[model samples]
Target: MKTIFSSLFLAAGANAIITRWAPCCFHLSASGAVTGTVGQLDDGQNRVNGPLSPAEYCIADGAITDANGRGCILTPPTSQWQCDTGATPTSGFSVACDGTVAYNGGTTFYECQTGDNGEANIYLTPGGTNCGEITLKADGCGSCPPPPPPPPTTCPTNLNGNYEFPHLIIPIDSSNPNSAAGTSYFGEVSSTISSIFNFDIPASDSGKTCSLIFLFPLQSQLTTSSFTFSGNGAIDFSLLSGVATVSTSYANAPSVETDYGSITVAPGNSYNVATFACPAGEAVSFELKAVGDTCLNYFQDYNPSPIGVYITTC
Candidate 1:
């Protein structure tokens, strides 16, 4: 070691010529553990060789003393080498030293820096200070994995909104005289009516549960709604194509039946009517007709104004 550093002391003013420096070797495992130690070169010298993986630095001065001790002399691949005393590091590198720089006026740790020629270099303590010999050790740190992605959005089993006014309402077929009143039948005269309401399911809400909401003002109501009811018990209805024109009878139009098990024609201020699978898009219509003896009055002189109606989907 003395022969290696002897020629360096003869270089110009404050700098020295560095050669024969041993590499501070390290190995990173597949599991992310880092291990290795300072090693000697073929010529056997105690100097440092590095561009350290996690970065390293010294606490005090960048000079080594003569007495042979492991130094805090570590170099990083980056332009600067920085490592705090006790903080969680992003690169997972840690700092360690054999002894403080001022121990008995002797330096146990020394800092490494880049020379003007871009080689690793260390400064020697001025003539008087003693540099002690010491060994170095450090542990590796691994990074944490990323968090899991959020769960998918799900559809609820029940209806979840108030009666919203539909964009369009058209009267189709009804047994009551006022059924001829067109869209007004829903808000005007007392009638057991057949009508259609806008049911546009958004693409985003496809495959989600959906329902039609209604405001039934007056009643002698049945518990369900269907097209072929046994006599005068339940009101009948069909889902027609959204493009179908208004008609006194749409009996022959291509249609789908409302699930009888899902219909509720009972008297109520608000009711969620689940039609067949109400798929997304504005391609379908709801048409209801009161067959036998059911009186569903949307508006009556004795009752308040009708509450608007709409659909709900999730």
Candidate 2:
């Protein structure tokens, strides 16, 4: 009887060890398919056994083992869950809430529409799984302003004047061969007339006749009513002849004829009428000739003479 008791005790000890050694924890393959035996449950009721259903499995607890026997961690939504409505997602499609891939449903959340989707992709720093989108704007951020308009151009100033002819003398004489009665006498005659005459007379036969007969070169300074300067530092002025008197006498005869005329002169205002625009620190000279109808007449009818040249300064 003692030997029988010993055998029973040994058998009981062996059964206890077998029951304690059975595994309780379970895992799944990476393909989402169930694999391996489900661990034995300690509960008196036979609640755990066989393959696990999708609804019954807790994703976090499922250990993933790949086909190659590599161990991995199982995550929620083992498969890509597409929307049921068959609506295609446009660029910048996004999810409003954080959830597993299984939560993607046509009715659950909003996504960018295919044709009307207006979004921009953005890159985040430090690297993360979450990528986001931004709204499309008519004008993008930081657009450059248009180039500044070109500077305006400035116009140059014009300095001009009017002139008149009051008198000219061209003497016809056939007297002493060396007589001052010819053109030679007119040079002195012009000087004398300019010193005397001072008045305005209508174009008259007296003025025309004297001019035609005795070619006398006559001129006078013009009085300016106003003078102005341009932006370019040029001066502009208008002048009118006050009056002039000129007379000529033949070298051989005592006969003399007097003539009168008027004229104007305007030098460029930017420079001095007398000096022009001579450079600073430089010795410069200008020869200003009195010009206008009087000068024209002298050049046209009178014998060549030096009386027409005039000079002024700044």
Whose lDDT is greatest here? 1
Clashes of each: 11, 24
* Stretches > 4 Å off in candidate 2: 1-121, 124-126, 129-147, 153-155, 158-314
- Candidate 1, residues 101-156, lDDT tens digits: the string is 22223223332423322222222321112222332332221122355664323323
TM-score of each: 0.34, 0.13
Q: Residue 209 error for model 2, in Å? A: 55
lDDT per residue as tens, model 2, 1-314: 00000111111211111112322122211111111222212211011123322111111111212222222221122211121112221111111122111111211211121121121111111121222222211111112335677532211111122112223322322333232332322221121111111113233322121110111122332222112211221111112122211232222222213212222322221211221221222221111112222221123211222222221111
